[model samples]
Target: MSSDLSLQQIAESVTKSVLNATDKDLEGFQKIIDETIKVRESHRNLQRMIKSYSTTMIQRS
Candidate 1:
């Protein structure tokens, strides 16, 4: 399922989960890290889009 949560908020939740997790739960923690990377990548993509849009608008004006 998809979520409306922000990357920073999800990252913080994952961080807290990892801190309290046991050594046997490392695999799940790794999954959380992978998801966090995806979130960050998505944020980067959004930033790029905004920058491109702003540049195009400036050139038009």
Candidate 2:
């Protein structure tokens, strides 16, 4: 009976550890995703500026 209790305790500890590690990993992934979105938005804005400048130059020419 004691052995069974020890086994149950070990299983619960391992489960908690695994859950915590997974949560940390998910947080890291979310941060990466957020940064990627920001970078992509900046790139798009830069492209729009370039396009506008090119159009203006063509009209001036």
Candidate 3:
């Protein structure tokens, strides 16, 4: 009786721990994705700036 109750408690605790860890992993994954998007956008902006500068130089030449 007591042993069965202990086992049930342990199982519930394990389930809760697994769920919390999964939530943390998802949050971390989302943060990484957001950072990746920011880096990609910055790269695109830099490329546009370079292209514009090149066009201006070509026009002057």
Candidate 4:
């Protein structure tokens, strides 16, 4: 399986878990939320890095 597919699967599972969680599951839900935020932040940073690198390459040509 590709990394993208795996990540998508993991995200789906987390979403379902959060939706079905009870009050007792608050800690689990919090962990999921935190992980999601970290993933989003990482993704944004990666995009910015790639954009900067690509822009530099274009300018160097």
Candidate 5:
């Protein structure tokens, strides 16, 4: 009976640990996704600026 209890306790601990790790991983993924979005937006803005400058230069020429 004691052995059974010990096994159950071990199983619960392992389950909790796995769940915590999964949560941490999800948080990391979300941060990465957010950063990637910001980077993409910045890139788009830079491209727009470059395009506008090129057009202005062409008009001047």
Candidate 6:
């Protein structure tokens, strides 16, 4: 499978695995939330990098 497909599978697994829980799962939930936030920030950075690279290429061309 492609990397996107793999990631989707992993995300689905995590969602399904935690769909039902209680206060005892707080630690697990916190870790997931933090990881998700980090992933989102990383994606934003990647988008910015790509935008900058394309802008420079367009200017040079």
Best by lDDT: 1
Give the range where candidate 4 is weakest over 10 consecutive residues by summed lDDT. Answer: 1-10
The residue-level lDDT of candidate 3 at 49 comes to: 100
> lDDT at 12 for candidate 4?
84
> RMSD of each candidate?
5.6, 16.7, 16.9, 4.3, 16.9, 4.0
For candidate 3, the TM-score is 0.64
Backbone clash numbers for all candidates listed = 0, 0, 0, 0, 0, 0
Deviating ranges (above 4 Å) for candidate 1: 1-24
Native-referenced Cα lDDT, model 6: 0.85
- Considering summed lDDT, which 10 consecutive residues are worst modelled in model 2? 1-10
Off by over 4 Å in 3: 1-21
Please give each candidate's TM-score.
Answer: 0.60, 0.63, 0.64, 0.62, 0.64, 0.62
Comparing 2 with 5 on TM-score, the higher-scoring candidate is 5
lDDT of 5 by residue, 1-61 (tens): 3445575786687676556677677688679779989999999999999999999999999
Which model, 1 or 5, shows the larger lDDT? 1
Off by over 4 Å in 6: 1-24
**How well does candidate 6 match the true structure in TM-score terms?**
0.62
Q: What is the overall TM-score of model 5 with all chains considered together?
A: 0.64
Model 6 Cα lDDT, one tens digit per residue, 1-61: 5456576787788786677766679687889789999999999999999999999999999
Give me the runs in candidate 5 sitting further than 4 Å from their true place. 1-21
Alpha-carbon error at 54 in model 3, in Å? 0.3
Residue 23 of model 2: what lDDT? Answer: 69
Q: Estimate, for each residue in 1-47, the C-alpha lDDT of model 2 and write its tens digit.
A: 34455757866876765566776776886797799899999999999
Error of 1 at 57 (Å): 0.6
